[model samples]
Structures are given as structure tokens and as C-alpha cells.
Target: MADKCHMCLLGLIILCPLLTGMNGAETTHVFCSSGENVHLPCNIALSGCTSTTWNYNRHSSAVEMVSGGKKKNDIERHERLSLGSDCSLNIKNTKEDYGSYSCIQYVNGQQQGTDAHVHLHVLHGQCFCKSHV
Candidate 1:
């Protein structure tokens, strides 16, 4: 009996860190051309998400992109904005859309939350001023 208890304690000690690591927020960088479409991954596997929002540094605050199974008015909203069933955000890439974004996940009747951080970089054309000799 003592040996079984000892083994259980050892198992907890080894798995504690791994379990905690699963809850950590993941950060990723995405680069897209100024006139293309780019998809930002969010809740790829989480279910029962009561609400979800996407916050961008370019905006004043978090915008309710998806709520109550619908999309709300957001400052970042564009004609090509698309929300996937998995909660991924698809945006028509533009220079104005280049910024750090956070996908917030909310569960019903829960206070704690999880999120994914993404940094968007828009590739734009370069112009050079040339002077003829």
C-alpha cells in the first residue's frame, strides 16, 4: 500500500509541469501580402466557447468578433472578414490590419479564460525615388 502511494506521488510530480504547460497561451507570427487573405488560428480544439473576441493593437479595445453565434460590429471589420467554425479569423490582408492580435476565449459560467496571441505583418510594395543624371 505504501509503495502504491509513493508511486502515485512520483507520478504527480512528473506530470504537474506538463499539465500546467497545456494552459499556457501560444504566440505565433503571421505574414501576409497587403492584398491577400490570411487566416489567424484561434480555438482549434476548444469547445463550448460561450463567446470569442479578437483584439488588435490598432484598435482601442477588444472587439466582439463572434458572439452568440454571430458576428458583431468591429472597427476591424472588413468586407472579406470570415470566421471559421473552429474560431479562426480570416481577414483580407491590408496594411492597416498589421498589428498584434489576441483571440480571447470565454466559456459559459466560467471566470477563467484562455487566449492565443498573433502578430500580423503585412508586406507592402516598396517605392524608390530615382533621379536622372
Candidate 2:
């Protein structure tokens, strides 16, 4: 019985930090309309990041959007993809851009901050017109 108790304690010690780290990360969502610019706020300052990456679609092949200062590279780079002064992601609104976007921040290439998960929901647009009788 004592041996089993010791093993359990050891297991908890090993796993405690892992669990805490995962809990430290956060996930949030945002909604946007098609044909409008959307800001997925990370709220982490640019000065705080040595590296920053945005990932799209949590389950599918994760598409990475890179940005740091004026340097950015990725498919969405041409479409006015930008990071705000506060490190929020600004995406030129489109139906294709609707999905889960995750912002992972790093200091000196070590993940050490709250992660952001922004869900971009693009509402289907409609036009209303009055009938002239």
C-alpha cells in the first residue's frame, strides 16, 4: 500500500506543471461579417513578442500566418493581413477567412504567454430592397 501511494504522488508531481501550463493558455472567439475587416484581438503587446504566429482551422491542416514588425509571410499576406499595434490580428474579411484562428505568443522563441483562439464567423450577407408599386 505504501509503494502504491508513493507512485501516485510521483505521478502527480510529474504531471502538475503540464496541467498548469495547459490551463494557463486561453481560448476566445470573435464573429465578423463578410466583406468587412475583422480584428481578432490577442491583447499581447508587440514589444512582448520575440515571435508570433497565427494558426487557422484547429482540426484541419493548420495554416500558419507569420508576422513580426513590418515582416510578414503567408498566403493571406497579400490580402491586407496585418498585426495591430497591440499584436491583434487584422484580417481582411472574407468567407474563406472564417474559422478558428489561434494566436501563440513567444518570448525569445519560448512559449510563455496566454494563447488566443479567435473564431471568425462570417455571417451570410443579404440585401433588402423595397418593392415599388
What is each predicted model's overall lDDT from 0 to 1?
0.58, 0.59
Where is model 1 more than 4 Å wrong at Cα? 1-25, 48-50, 59-62, 74-76, 109-113, 126-133
lDDT of 1 at 124: 55
TM-score of 2: 0.63
- In the predicted model 1, the residue pairs found to clash are none
lDDT of 1: 0.58
Question: Mind giving the per-residue lDDT tens digits that candidate 2 earns over 79-128?
Answer: 57877777777777455677777777776667756667665655444311
- Cα RMSD of predicted structure 2: 16.5
Instruction: State the lDDT of candidate 1 residue by residue for 84-127, as single tens digits.
Output: 77877778645567776777765664523566776665645431
Question: How many residue pairs clash (N, CA or C atoms closer than 3 angstroms) in each of the candidate models, in the order given?
Answer: 0, 0
Residue 116 of model 2 has an lDDT of: 71
Provide the lowest-lDDT 10-residue window in model 2: 124-133
TM-score per model over all chains? 0.60, 0.63
